[model samples]
Target: NALTPPNFIKSIIEEDLRSGKVKEVVTRFPPEPNGYMHIGHVRAIFIDFALADEFGGRTNLRFDDTNPAKEDVEYVNSIKEDIKWLGFQWDNQYYASDYFDEMYNRAVLLINKGLAYVDDQSADEIRENRGTLTEPGKNSPYRDRSVEENLDLFTRMKNGEFKNGERVLRAKIDMASPNINLRDPVIYRISHTTHHNTGDKWCIYPMYTFAHPLEDAIEGVTHSLCSLEFEDQRPFYDWVVRECEMEAQPRQYEFGRLNVSTMVTSKRKLRKLVEENLVDGWDDPRMPTVSGMRRRGYTPEAIKSFIYETGISRSQGLIDIQTLEHFVREDLKLKAPRTMAVLRPLKVVITNYPEGESELLPAENNTENEEMGIRQIPFSREIYIEQDDFMEEPPSKYFRLFPGNEVRLKHAYFIKCHDFIKDENGEVVEIHCTYDPATKSGSDFNARKVKGTIHWVDASSAVPAEFRLYEPLLGEDEESEELAADETNDVSADEVDDFLKKVNKDSMEVVQGFVEPQLKDAQPQDKFQFFRHGYFNVDPKLSEPGKPVFGRIVSMKSSFKL
Candidate 1:
């Protein structure tokens, strides 16, 4: 963590503190509780918590629940869990709805100052009038309404007298401004839906843009850090705090949003994937959600380390997802116990070894971590090796278990394949081999050298398990096309359909396997390095007593380096 590169945001915070421009570096992670937090949110969460903590300041966990129709308590709870799991705790917790009354009062103040007006334009009409970047916007006919009439209309709208979108309160800003966001944006809209927090107490809700700045000011947040997409709205943010006469002004700062290649962080797309049964749920191991990564055995240390290394900047760069996997591997290598798990198991009968006889072999839990000590693995006459480990006709350089070729069985004896059994379909079902007793592991039997080492589990003691291997849900090329088509994040139904079509059907593959008996009691979330296979974590949601399910966290090798 100390080696993480310093970011411009940190420099700005230091200068602010040094100049007495900021008394304390109070920040907030305000997430709308509409969906689970994804990997993309990790950047914001880290910046908010880390920067504040670095300055001996505090951060607040605020739920931007202004959009009651889309928000839910489930998302709120999940967000909190994710933040805690990442090892950062908020100094205070707040919700945007908690200050709805205050926000309404502020709107009233704006109306009183003749800085806001009631707009009766239809949503379509409003959009049409809000001209493009090349043109200036046209003022609403209702924009110049008298202060008294505007106040009465806004009050009536809040009283549930107006249907949803029938009326809205608009800030009376410039219509001819080059920045279209300053063109009298809608500040409030009538929504009759019940709020998760407020219930039926209120019928109208403040727009997110209008409510966010007020929430920051009310909470005394000194720095309102957000993604680059919100940079265009910073002017409105400042306008709200200043015109509303908020005693505590929170300045807004923008940082580049983290984007990972081949990752879909759009909440709508994620929700569609779950609803359409394209994925198991939000916590599917293949998902990019924090819960998903956690369930897949990604460590908090790895995620935090990834965030630090990625750093913060004004340039939005597409990061290779492998960089993240690199961190996970780095964090897990020494911690996870090493064990053998034969996926696609092929029964191997050591004909020369005595039948019904088994012995315990000592194997280091982790070669690099002697502190983990050693674990006893079962070795027997009959054992299961990876099907791919043996070949009747092997190519050159294939040093594993070809006929007459000897290979060391990890933690056991060197075994030489002599013959194999084939099913009626001519598929190799089993292999016949002979183990050299003199070549037992830990013995001083280096009479000859073997070119290959393979891993296996004792057939008698191997635990039946399920291994869930994963690939990226979206291919890199498809993801690039999707991003190019949908830059606004406002996905349409057709776009969703097209995106779903691009979902990799083979993203996940479940195969029955055998793990060493030492893993028979492996609890959910327990992590281990499968010998010559990959790193895996016990599936928290599916693993049951005596029937463990392991999700491959990452492969054993990666071309990427940190």
Candidate 2:
């Protein structure tokens, strides 16, 4: 159980302890309970939990559930489950809603201190008062209210005495600062909505920027870990904690968020895709969500490995999605059992084999884990090969089936195509091949050199299955431009809007196929390599008894034909 060494965050924590920045470190992962956790969240989770683990500190799982309008118990539970699945335990479970009463009292304290005020102006009017980056903002007309009047108004605002968004409690910070967040940010606003946790206890709620630092200070968190988007808001975060007069003000650190190419991680956009039926659900195997990756058969070890290999860098960059797929492929290659499945089946008749006779062929279950043992597959006269396995007219480099070409039926015997039959459509209906009786696979077949080996399943022994092939969910050009925008270098607003319009339309394709008999009883999440086919995982949500649904994980090679 050797632990790996320091990323920038861990390095900082180590140095902090050496300098006695407080005896031990404490970190917190505060995710808003609005949507499922995605890979981007995993990066923060790993850094938060892993850094704590390295320094023998503690990590808290806290839900920044201030936005009750979108937050739900469903999302909260999903976040907890995903973190546990990633193999991290929370030192304590807390919610921003848990401190609603305390946060309200703090707001009252700010009003009594004349450091905050109740503004009756509309949200738009407030925006107008807050001038451009190059100009100073004018103060609110009510900015000079007596402390007693402000406290009374704020108390009424909390008591459900005002319409939603009619009034907001604003921090009385400088309006002329270059940082917009510091221009008297909204600490709390009126919202007549029921909270998932508190349930109709209050009508007003605290905004994220105000609640987050208060949460860190209350929990005694030593390190407030967040993404780079929060970099500009760092000063406001520090101000809130300081204004609260906390003894130990938690330090905030920012790092670039994780981005994967060809994948959209925005919750709003992902929700749009789900609501528009662009995908089956939030857990669609092609989605970048943790649940989606789990359904797609990606192992926890593979995800952890990808996180480690990507490393923690302050410079933001878009990671090639293929890199993540490659780790999954490499990890599964040494673990998953091998089987045979024929998609787009083509009939092949072993003309020389006795009619009504079948043979048991030995096949390796897993090449990397021999102790997994081998399984026996039924081989018969009539078999099904991939439709693409044969070409009626052969190319010079083609090593597979043609009228006179010889190839090995994997794990069985070498067969030479002698003839074929065609239907009225001129499509090859069946291929006739003669087996080399002396070259049966278990005997001298291993020594007989062949240009190609193709996978086949016994026609009568094959089990019906559904194969799901996934492609990129965004158009090539659009995805590239979107990636550029996310890097925050530069892009026109028109380009941004048009790129979002090209969201993936044909992201999923389902087809009927046949799998080996061993797969008839396969359970959910069972992973396997379909011999010459790609790696697949049994989809738990769509799979049924005797009717397995498999999602293609990744191909054996980039040049894979089927």
- Give the residue spans of candidate 2 off by over 4 A: 1-5, 442-448, 476-500
lDDT accuracy of residue 378 in candidate 1: 84
Cand. 2 TM to true fold: 0.94
**What lDDT score goes with residue 318 in model 1?**
81
Instruction: Residues 1-562, candidate 1: write the lDDT tens digits.
Output: 4323598878888899999989889999998888999998998999999899888899999998888888877998999999999999999999889999999999999999999999999989999999988998998999889999998998899888989889989999999888777899888988889888999999998888889889999999999998887888889999999999999989999988788888887888889999998888999999989999999899999998998888888777788888999999999999999989999899999999888888899999999999999989988889999888888888888888988999999888999989999999999998999988999999979899999998899999899999999999998755432232111345778988999999998999999989999799999999999987789999999999999999999998742111
Global lDDT scores for all candidate models:
0.89, 0.84
Report the Cα lDDT for candidate 2: 0.84
The TM-scores, one per candidate, come to: 0.96, 0.94
Among all windows of 10 consecutive residues in model 1, the one with the lowest summed lDDT is 480-489
Clashing pairs in 1: none
